[model samples]
Target: MEKLIKIISNRAVLIVLLILIQLGVLFAIVFRFQNYFVYFYTFYLLISSAVIIKIINSRSNPAYKIAWIIPIMLIPIFGTVIYLVFGRVRFSNKEKMKMAMVQERERMANESTVAKTTIDDGNPNAIIQSNYLSKHGEASLFEHTTSEYYPLGEEAFKAMIEDLEKAEKYIFMEYFIVHEGEMWDTILEIMVRKAKEGVDVRFIYDDFGCLFTLPHGYDKKLRDQGIKCCVFNQFIPVLSPIFNNRNHRKITVIDGKVAYTGGINLADEYINRIERFGHWKDNSIKVEGEAAWGFSLLFLSMWDFVNSTESNIEEFIPEYAPGELPENDGYYQPYVDSPFDRETVGMNVYLNLINRATEYVYFTTPYLVIDNLLMEALCNAAKGGVDVRIITPHIPDKWYVHAVTKSNYAQLIEAGVKIYEYTPGFIHSKTCVVDGLYATVGTVNLDYRSLFLHFECGVWMYKTNGVDAVLQDHMEIEKLSQQISLEQAKNVSFPKKVVRACLSVFAPLL
Candidate 1:
């Protein structure tokens, strides 16, 4: 009786009943409403048929194809309807081309500047330098930059504040998340002061990235303070379904010479002062030199897109030529990746490093939801006798996401890859060191979201001492992490495994 009542009370039943009643009324008025019914059914059938054809031809992953095939075969009409609205790629090709064109322009403008500084005075291994240029198309330029790797967020914050205080010409800051907290307050104060002093302060924050953290009209509030602000991809409540795409980049370029990038965000939690998760262990790198110009261009490109204004590239160029630092480091090539383009530059860079690893590959990411290509690359590396170790969070902030992360454990473990979970708190660092020769630090996570949905940036370094520092930090993190054995992973509860399996099916969508 309860089940019957529940079924009767369902909204679907009400909708169906309304449709039937409307049909009956239409039939009764057929003499007068003949054109209305004819046009309605005709348009419906035309849309349904078109949807079916699109579903039959749409591009998708193997898992998505198999999952969608069942529904497409079972219910042709409704399946086609759903696929047309949601199954197909959400972004338009025209928009993608526009993004690509913009990026190409920006790259072309910076290429000359990048090429002029290719001689590495620090003189890294010739082989490694050639490999980077060949594999990533990034010429290893002489980077006379002082890089300070902050192992914790507090140290990074202090450094960022100091750099912001020293801003003279312009301050271009971009981040994925900036919550209303002590960290943001401090930064906001600096931005306001800089704007007041006619310092040309500009900001670009991801809209979806800070959906709940920021209130409506926040951009206007910043503009009112004389600080130029642009929210990337304004969020709309009505378009809540398309929330997968986001700007997942954190960049700060001060005076087009000093820059900062890493996993750290402008939030108190990152500093460990407000412990929402655990210790909030994260890392950031501060760069000051010709390399900082690359980051400045990246920020200016996004700013141009948001503000719909042409960026004067020459205006941002430093008056004095970038001279080598007293203690110069090797080339630092900081590049960005956009989902708008088909090329997965950042992902390919990582895969190449993993494939070329002769000794060891160390990785730290908050999530480990990987696609087939990445999984096979890492597994093959491990099988070929490379020591592969990854550190993830033990206390996950998202239980479902954590389950999805662990679901791939069986395959990785069987392939000889070691896994560890940080016991103290969440490990939010997205970093990798391969053979102690190549190290990457940036906003790219080991997941589909970072790889295929969001805008991300990272610095690829070879022969820079920063690689050693990142490896040392990894070693220190290993002490705080607990290794997960194949035995333990295999014995996970059946119910939990079922949930993980279900979540894995939707990993791409997540």
Candidate 2:
């Protein structure tokens, strides 16, 4: 009874039930009016044609358009109605106004931190990529910054607590998941103490991501402890597609001088303290100096959005160095991506890295449901002998997603793109290292939702300790991962392969 009650009380279960009930009623109504079937059929055709046309014209992935088109063509009855409710990407008027405020504040913050970093004229590739992010993502490149890499979540947790312990002014954290466990408990203890000390401690977690992991009134508990807490896009029991827009970013900014980001979430499983998917593998970067300010601004942008309040963003900005600056630690540029933005910054960044790789490019992502453009880029890079490699999970968190991920492996392997699966367990790390010189570490996954629908963030680095650390971590992961050969991928059973292919069509939705 207790387990049943808990299952029914889950927000996801409730939302699913509500949507199913509404859909069932709609279907019943349509079936009841059988006498006007011809007219209904005509209306359905017209609506579906219009929706399909609109989807083709929208600024989205080709695979995504094809995915929707296939289903709409097959089930013309309910397809158009579904498309009308979920297909449109335009934000509601209220959401637009709020996002405008956040974007404008982000612009203000970006403007205040003009690019003071300079690169050698010989390193034109680095400068070009950095310029691209600066122009489109409103990010600044920093030169005099240092970075430390944690190849495992356990290492990052230790470093994070140390940083939190030393924070003098403020702390800001935004993450997709924040489950209650030994991990979050230890972090919360420090955060509560810091809040009582009058530090401006602020936290933001995605409501849907933590819906089952956290209690319904958990935000109030944090507030009672003097910590400012807000849930991003609080989950509502509705059938709107806007619920898909999740904040998938993981960020921590302390005193505006130290910051961290990567795949690790505030959950015990992430650190392998309480394993759910065997041994969990993840990575993170600890940055200091002016580069750290970039993450601070990123956090404040979302913070402003959640609180619906704007102040002098400059007041929260902290100088990485008050006196003399440290030695140059190469260039670092942090950027963000949102479904609201016209440009897909994360996708383009990956493309740029692949397109410009002179030697090799390696990446680690839990999911691999990519669009044609990224697939083409990887294949072309591999054909050009760029040594393209990718690491996906052996122990998947979602079976359907794993099936879809493996569906693309055959194509990639045939193109000479080497693929590996972490044999030990799941690897939730989202990282890419290119040419031993450039790398990125953050929450941007290789899937459609992370690339297109979600709000994500990542840090691009060139010739910095961050790049080396990420490269080293990837190499270590390679050692523990089992490589997938073209023959091995081709030997899958026909029935299983068919199911995987079918699942791939719905990859965007997954």
Candidate 3:
């Protein structure tokens, strides 16, 4: 009976049924008024034309504009409806007002965050990148902040559990996916016990991301256990473009002393307890000092927005014994990318790292769907004597996306860039290491969804332990991966090549 209820009440089923019914009714209307068909068709065509024009004139991604234009011109009747429901990635004016207010309050409170920290001006590349994040991304740069990188998901999980158990004041966690398994059960038990012990515990999960993984009204269930929970952007059964933007960030902050972020979600597969597509490979990082404060504020801002309440920034500040933190390192900066901000913080960071590379740049991403600008920068860097390498999943979780990933391989290989597919299994880590001096790790992928339509975060380190660790990990992982050459990319069957070419046209929407 429970299984039957799930099948009947599935959100996907309901959405499809509703859409089909609406489409049927519209067809009936058009058939009944056949005499005015020309007028109706003309009106929709004009609307579609206007939308296409607006898209071309707007400052959005070129690929996104071209993708939308194809459908509008090919299927003029229903294209406008589809575009209205998914193409517009903007919030209403009222939401913009509220966001402005939130930014203002946070900005005033963060004026002192990086006032004392300085990036060495000797590296003009590092200086410009740090300033861009501070002024545009509203993130601070910190010096002497300790960082630890985990090459495996299970390693990060074990370290995170240890940190969570030590929470004395508060625990904040925000993730894109939270499945009920050994991994989540273990963390949930810790959170439940900590909440009962008076530790302020909070969890924020994206509703759309957990649509099938979690039970309905899961937030209320957590709230009943004394854990403050917020369902980020509740998913209702409808066709709306606002729902396209997702909270893809995975973050955890323990009393502002320790924080974790990466591509690892709260699921058994991430930890490799169970296999879905062979061995699951991923990475995560732990910041254990003043830099953790940055992730804490990042979570609080999203929490405040969802709950409509401003939290006291001072209340969650880190309090530690004199000798608690590890000795200082080099510069560390944590920043976020959001659709609301309309700035591609993650993409720009990757571009800056690639363009400024004097020695080499390495990347690991599950998806390799990127725009022309990033592709050009990487090719240029490789051509100009800078080594460029990217590692992607050999065993794909999504075949279509993997095809799109392969579609760009020949061009990259032609320009001297090297590509590798992880032979072990899926490499679900979003990370970049450059020149053994700069590194970043978090949830930002090279794909369009992560770059333009999701909320994401990462830590950028310069000349720190993290940089060395990340570079070493990349080099080690490369040994386990198989290099894809230009011959392999271009020797595909004709039908496969045609499919990939078609898929590439809509890669941005993937």
Candidate 4:
């Protein structure tokens, strides 16, 4: 009886049941009025036609448009309605106003006139990418910042726990997934203890991302322990495109003095306490010094946006004392990407690095599913004599996504780009290193979801120790991975090829 009750009360289960019920009623109404359906059929066609026109004319990706166009044209009954519900939502006037305010607050928080660092001493490639991000992506370049790169999630976890122990002012954590296991338990223990000691602790977890990992009332439970918790975009039974906009960021800030961000989540799978897909692999970068200020304001802005309350963000603005500033390790700029800005910051950053590579470019991503533009850039770089290499997972967490990832291999391999699959297990790290001088490590996958739909973040480095560390890690992983040749990549079965073709049609949605 208890198991049955738990299943019935599961939040994800209840939402699915409610949506199914609504669909049933709608279909029943249509069938019951079949004699008068001739009038409605024309109306539905008009709606679908209008939606197709809007999609074609909108600033959406061409492949994304084709994905929806085929379906709406074929099934005119419910296709238009579904498209409206799951389509990419443009920034509304209200959203624009709120986001503008948040951006302004972020600017004011980092308004210190710390002289910008010069990159002419090293490579000019860093200067071009850094200037692009500063001018358009709102990522400010900083010196006097020290950074360390961890090639594994567990190592970064240990570092984060140590930093958490030293928090005197506040702690901010935002993650996509927070499963209740040893990983989260260890972190929560520290967060709760700090809260008891008068440290302000704030946590934000995405509702959709943690739907199955955590209980629905997890936020309330945290609040009861004196830890402030806000669930990002609470999942409701109603279908709306707003639910698709997820906060897919992993960030931990300690008193605005230290921070960490990468692909690791607060889950056992991330740290490999227990693995779902062979040995789980990930990476992270630790930032100390004034650059941690970037992550601090990023958290506060989202806090204000969710609560609909304008906070006195100046209160949390970090000011680094001259003695407190670390040695000039190198240039560090941690930036975030949002759907509202009409800028795909993560994808563009990747493009810039690939385009500007002099010797080689390396990437470690779980998914290789990409649009034609990105695919073309990879091919162009490889065909231009740049040694381009990518490492994806051998043991996939999702079979369908792995299939899509493999579907991309043959095309890239044909263009002389090397593709390798991790032999031991899944590689969930999102990292890119170019010419041994520039690198970015964070939570942006190569799929459309991470590139265009989700809110993402990463740290761009130039002439930093972190860059060398990331390049070394990539080289080591390449040794442990299996390279796919043109023959192997093109050896798919006939039926499987058909399946891949169909899946590719909807790759934008995937």
Q: Number of the top candidate by lDDT?
A: 3
lDDT of 4 by residue, 318-425 (tens): 677669889988789988888887788999999999999978999999998899999999999999999999999999988888888999999999999999999999
Candidate 4 is scored at a TM of 0.97
> Between which residue pairs do clashes occur in model 1?
none
Q: What is the TM-score of each candidate against the true structure?
A: 0.85, 0.96, 0.97, 0.97
Give the Cα error of residue 276 in candidate 2, in Å: 1.5
Model 2, range 1-510, lDDT digits (tens) per residue?
999998997777887798888878877887876569888788777878888888899877888888888878987677766766576566788877897888877877777665666678578888889989987775788877889999999999999999999988899999899988888999999999999998989999999899878878788999999999998988876667877789999999998888899999999998989978889998889888778888888888788887887856767777544664557888889899888877899999999999999899999999998988999999999999999999999999999999999999999998999999999999999998998899999899999899999999989999888888888888889999999998888889999989998998889888
lDDT of 3 by residue, 1-510 (tens): 999887878876666678667767765765566668788778777887788889999999999889888987887566666788778897888777776677666676677453557776588889998998887675888865798899999999999999999999999999999999999999999999999999999999998888878987899999999999999988875667887799999999999888999889999999999998777989999998888888888888888888878888888878768888667798888898878877889899998899899999999999999999989998999899899999999999999999999999999999999999999899999999998889999999999999989989999999899999998899899999999989998999999999999999999888
The Cα local distance difference test for each model comes to 0.78, 0.87, 0.88, 0.88
Alpha-carbon RMSD to native, per candidate: 7.2, 1.6, 1.6, 1.6
**Tens digits of per-residue lDDT for model 1 on 248-328?**
989999997788999998888999989887789899998887778878888888887776677878888755544443256
Runs with alpha carbons beyond 4 Å of true place in candidate 3: 1-5, 19-35, 113-115
Worst 10 residues of 4 by lDDT: 109-118
For residue 274, what is the lDDT in candidate 3?
94
Residue 396 lDDT in candidate 3: 95
RMSD of 4: 1.6
